[model samples]
Target chain A: MTDETMLEEDGHSGGVVKKFLYVNRRAPYGSIYALESLEVVLIGAAFEQDVSLLFLDDGVFQLKKGQDTAMTDMKNFSPTYRALEMYDVEKLYADRESIEQRGLTEDDLIVPVEVLSRDEIKDLMAQQDVVLSF
Target chain B: MKFSVLVNEGPYQHEASDSAYHFTKAALEKGHEIFRVFFYHDGVNNGTRLATPPQDDRNITQRWSALAEQHNLDLVVCVAAAQRRGIIDADEMKRHGKDANNIAPGFRISGLGQLIEAGIQADRLITFGD
Candidate 1:
């Protein structure tokens, strides 16, 4: 790396673990936001922060099973959600309203997520040191 | 109040970048410390020097370049995001065999770890996007 790049790499938290939340609000395949956001989560997993992934609004569809992107021609990235556990990113939450409004049951989602009420989601966000939404 | 700003959109397609620029300017004017300004996704386009908008309109890329100059800001474009958008730097051009790097002044391309570090160090990590 050049000296200029090194200037930005200076100073990392030695052991202070901040609660970092990645909130996905866009659906998969509609736009690149969901896929790109997941890339951030995976890249950031190395930092070992208290990371969490919350799927709300259209983002809830990202975890739905049977996502065949062959027709859409976009890469099927839905399966990557399952591999997040391997990276030690275990905290996954889903907004209850968004799921129900879309007529999706708990079993409809591919990955297991703690269905959170509106107030619960607010409380979860309030506790986070940093919250990033897509 | 130390802040790290995240810009998630491109220069002109969305108001996110414009709002982020104004907010960053206002924050610096208020004498607040800015840890970093991260550009991700299409936000990486804000760091491209080749963007030529109309003469009358505000040149968003130059605005950020000027802001970084004035504030000595650490303006970082995510390496992964930039690569996807073809926003190559001089070093990247050599490494990737890309001709003609188009990165704007005062912006350095780096990893997402910088974003993580910003969250850890800054008082607040503010995100501007749709």
Candidate 2:
């Protein structure tokens, strides 16, 4: 479900909803942080909180398409990104500068995410009630 | 003021757990209400009762349990993260058909909703991690 639908269903009508931003700043597979952060996001969705996912630095690689963990012997959980929508977590943002520095484009990602400039991303972060980074 | 603390790293291996513990202590001492302390990722390891550190060092798990007992603080370990890292309570042990449980005192295994709930209920949410 989308955030709009969630707002309508809850009849928010100006009710205060805490905005939580899960900041992903690490690469996937190299450590358990990325995968675990996603787990928290999935669980947080049940509370109907205003949730947004931010991908910055090496974290952007977590959403890259065609991840193969066969050689690394790690379970490839990248596909879970597509399921975020089912949990009403529709606000996905990626840092434009980070992507450009890595020589990647939005086309390289597996999900549809808004690529925001550094200043815009900072503004977004400032608006959140809570920011959890991993 | 109300505060929520998030521990993102385990004990011994990282200072995140210790930092969170001290921070919680100071907050409570200053008359702040701790809504919850949500342990995630490696942080879930802090809830395990099986850790046996050197005699000269501090027992992190015991310290947390004691602090919680004194203040009635909510210490929650993420169930999914705990299950993955072999941290289980009596109920989970029975349900999963495991031999024994290793969750320490003053801590409970719960879902991720608790973390979000902490954020919503508290005036400030502080995270300590690597």
Best by TM-score: 1
lDDT values, one for every candidate: 0.90, 0.88
Sliding window of 10 residues with minimal summed lDDT for model 2 chain B: B110-119
How far residue A97's Cα lies from its native spot in candidate 1, in Å, is 1.5
| Residue A86 in candidate 1, Cα distance off native in Å | 1.0
- Give the C-alpha miss distance for residue A25 in model 2, angstroms: 1.1
Chain B global fold similarity (TM-score) for predicted model 2 against the true chain B: 0.98
lDDT of 2 by residue, B10-88 (tens): 9988898999999999999999999999998889999998899999999999999999999999999988778888999
lDDT by residue for model 2 over A10-59, one digit each (tens)?
A: 22213458888999999997898898888778767766778999999999
In model 1, which runs have C-alpha deviations exceeding 4 angstroms? A1-12
User: lDDT by residue for model 1 over B23-127, one digit each (tens)?
Assistant: 999999999999999999899999999989999999999999999999899999998888888998999899888878999999999887888888988999999
Q: Which of the numbered candidates is closest to the native, going by highest DockQ? A: 1
**Candidate 1 residues A1-134, lDDT tens each?**
12224334433678889999999998898799999888888777777899999999999999999999888789998889999999899999999999999999999999999999999999999999999989
lDDT score for candidate 2 against the true structure = 0.88
In terms of lDDT, which candidate is strongest? 1
